[model samples]
Target: MVFDGLTETAVAGRPAWRHDASGVLFRRVPGGTYQMGLSDAEMAALSAHADASVMLDDAHRMRPIRTVTVEPFLMARHPLTVAQVRHWLPDYEDDYVDDDDAAAHLEDEWLDALLEALPFRLPSEAEWEYAARAGTTTLTWRGDEAPTEEQLLDRFGVEAEVAATENPFGLAAMGSLTERCADRYGIGYAEPAPADGPPVVRGGAADASPWQGCGEWLLALPASRGWQDMFTSIRPVI
Candidate 1:
């Protein structure tokens, strides 16, 4: 999408900015409240599939569907590409494009240092879901049609390609990478998260060729959740 000044400031509270040094563009997301979990119909559809029950059993954790409010904040227009990370770590090496492709294999210490040096912070899980949905209440940001068992299972994997198109917010790759977030992993929305829990990860990285699991593919849905991966990427917030 075009990064014109008019588009950047069109929204009342939302605004956009560009980090010249790293060439990372930030888009302002207009904040509002949204239902943060699976709808009744979605639950019913998944439960009806006997074979997928084992793979999707934990899907209940997204339940007790709650209305969550998110305040307006800036989010990276694209995942932090390897090229941008190289601005801070010049010697970094990767096959992905410097400006266009998402960065991966980031360690926690590196993220901490990057946050310390930059004006950005990691987004919360709620904020990530809100941005991914971009105002749509659907099974996937792509649509509301409940996916057939075969469709959901075969749609994403090592063989699948992450679409380059943007969501309504003009953000790209919302379903591409398993992005690390700031929230602790929890059992369910109604249950409290253990203090020692692993960090939450969202926006399933279906392109990760090394991950051969069936469950992670379901995370491609906007409402689906998962834990951080050894090769998770970052989509910073400001």
Candidate 2:
């Protein structure tokens, strides 16, 4: 489905700057309010799932779904690719390596060009979920039941392919990746962001069993910083 919400100012041109990576595309999501996390009712239902697929303790941190109001921003159309990320920080890789190295080796020209091209930055979990939902209030983007890992693989595959058909909002890979964002880990609507912590990641990750294809998120422990393995990736927004 085509999304009507987006801004007029996405990064437009400059083909020579990009190499190996497909040029990033962003969707302008109109500002509005939406439920940011699991609701009390939804949590209760998960507690009662017959197979214990949704653990209560594991989900407790995401409780108290709050109505989040976001400002208009252009969200990346796909999970940030390795090539795309490498373009900015040459030494970066989507791995659990030292996060200090995540951006240690950077090309000044690429950085300047990126800033000039657009206001590129990672999306917060709130913004990420808002764009991912696009307007739906269901378990999966297009389903009534929770999705499975196999489902995620069958649909998106490894590397999180750029979606051919987008969600209702025209956003891609929302369910296929446990998208890493800019917020400090352990942050929630009920509390303030910590001074230092592993960044929170949104959307389910491919190969992450049940979590993939479903709306479960992960909080990167400090031990796992700079880790953007198959399950971790950034979705830039302005």
Candidate 3:
């Protein structure tokens, strides 16, 4: 019932995210193959239901719904916090953008320090969705369609009060906050990653409609790329 630290009960039966020495929390994702991306019929149906405010011009970017085989890995139970990032590498800010300028701006020692200090890294696009799906076929880990404002508050609570309640996999905020993903990809499966394609932030934030969470995914620029919002956070996988 408690998610404070790694427990035999939590890790023995299912993969779990528990407190780490650095104060970060992580869950285990057992390896397996799963469908990734939208199907034609689902896309058409989703497009019909898509809200005008959150319209995505390119749904094809996540298409072809391929079956991906992943290796067993550990995932952050919650999005990485500014405090956590700073703990491992003191200079990284909470809203540090992961873009080219930011990367270039970082002290040469930061990356190496990050690699050495923590046993975590960002999750790939495929790995992210697979964990988000958590063995479901619907748009959300919760349901098949967009949810309402009431739905989100009731489910996870603001500030992750009830974050550990629903997701069977024990990974937090897959449908709530915009956490960082590792892939630098473009709009279509066939389209090559833009020479400038930035990594993506997955899941929906509190400010947006809960209905949008199932379909929300925003892109982030490289390092301290001033494009970050309050809801932007990091969810590293190892």
Please report the candidate that would top lDDT against the real structure.
1
lDDT of candidate 1 at residue 159, scale 0 to 100 = 22
TM-score per prediction, in order, is 0.76, 0.63, 0.66
RMSD of 3: 7.7
Top candidate by TM-score: 1
Error (Å) of candidate 2 at residue 217 is 10
In order of TM-score, best first, we have: 1, 3, 2
Candidate 1 versus the native: TM-score?
0.76
Candidate 2 lDDT, tens digit per residue, 80-189? 55556555656554343234312111223543444355346777777877776777765556543544444442132233333442566556556565556677766345
Backbone clash pairs for candidate 2 read: 6-28, 7-28, 177-204
Candidate 3 lDDT over 104-150, as tens digits, reads 11223553465467666778777887787777775566654554444
Question: What is the overall TM-score of model 2 with all chains considered together?
Answer: 0.63
Q: Which residues of candidate 2, in runs, are more than 4 Å off?
A: 1-22, 44-49, 89-119, 150-161, 207-231
Candidate 1 segments exceeding 4 Å error:
1-16, 45-55, 94-100, 145-164, 208-216
Which 10 residues in a row give candidate 2 its minimum summed lDDT? 218-227
